[model samples]
Target: MAWFMGAVLLLALLTALLAPRLLRLQQERQERRADEHYRKQLQAATDHAITTAVRARLAEPVVDLHITIPMRVTVGDVIARALEDFALEVPWDHAAAMLRHRLEFRGHARWPDLITDVFDDEEDHTP
Candidate 1:
């Protein structure tokens, strides 16, 4: 009886010790999967997507003002808009900052000028 009890206690102690590591492994796997998904999304993203994504993220959700926020524009739709706009390629975080800066200091009035200034293509006019 004593030996059996000792064996049972040892098993329980071992399981308790091992549980945290197992949980950590599970969490790591989830993070890896999430990262992979984000990578796939970034790959399929277009240049102007970064701009609209930033805009949507910055949008205010006002409740009492009779404002109902809508779902973010689809990635495919943003890519199509980018195709129409001829925007420059930018990394996600940088694009967000640039868009914010443009909206703040430059405003929508000079948007086209700002794009031309920031992403100048001298080659286009060289010929």
Candidate 2:
């Protein structure tokens, strides 16, 4: 009986000592997960905005001399280049703005001009 009581007391003491630390670790892990989720959501929104802009550009009739005449570049090449620029050079806010502008105006903006405008508008807006 004495040994059993001693063992129970030891187990309880160990649990009491470790419970708070375990709870703290769990809270930290949850916070990290939430932060990661937020970042992924932001990135998805940015990607969607940029892709929408590219789609709008492609859907428009090329009769308007807004797009640069590609001598050897295919449509796929242009789209790939636009995607790369959005990913590397254009900011998220600018991509979102471009998408909004394209949707609103339905105008074919030149690729170079679009990129220049994105860089020129330095407002910190959220998508």
* Candidate that scores best on lDDT: 2
Tell me the spans in candidate 2 whose CA falls farther than 4 Å from its real position. Answer: 64-66, 69-127
**lDDT per residue (tens digit) for residues 2-71 in model 1:** 9999999999999999999999999999999977765444434433454565466458566555644432
Candidate 2 on 87-117: residue-level lDDT in tens? Answer: 4343455444544454345443444335423
Q: Against the unseen true structure, what C-alpha lDDT does each candidate score?
A: 0.50, 0.52
Pairs that collide in candidate 1 are none
Top candidate by TM-score? 2
TM-score of 2: 0.55
Provide the lDDT at 85 for model 1: 55
lDDT for 88 in candidate 2 is 38
Off by over 4 Å in 1: 46-91, 94-127
lDDT of 1 at 125: 29
* Candidate 2, run of 10 with poorest lDDT: 70-79
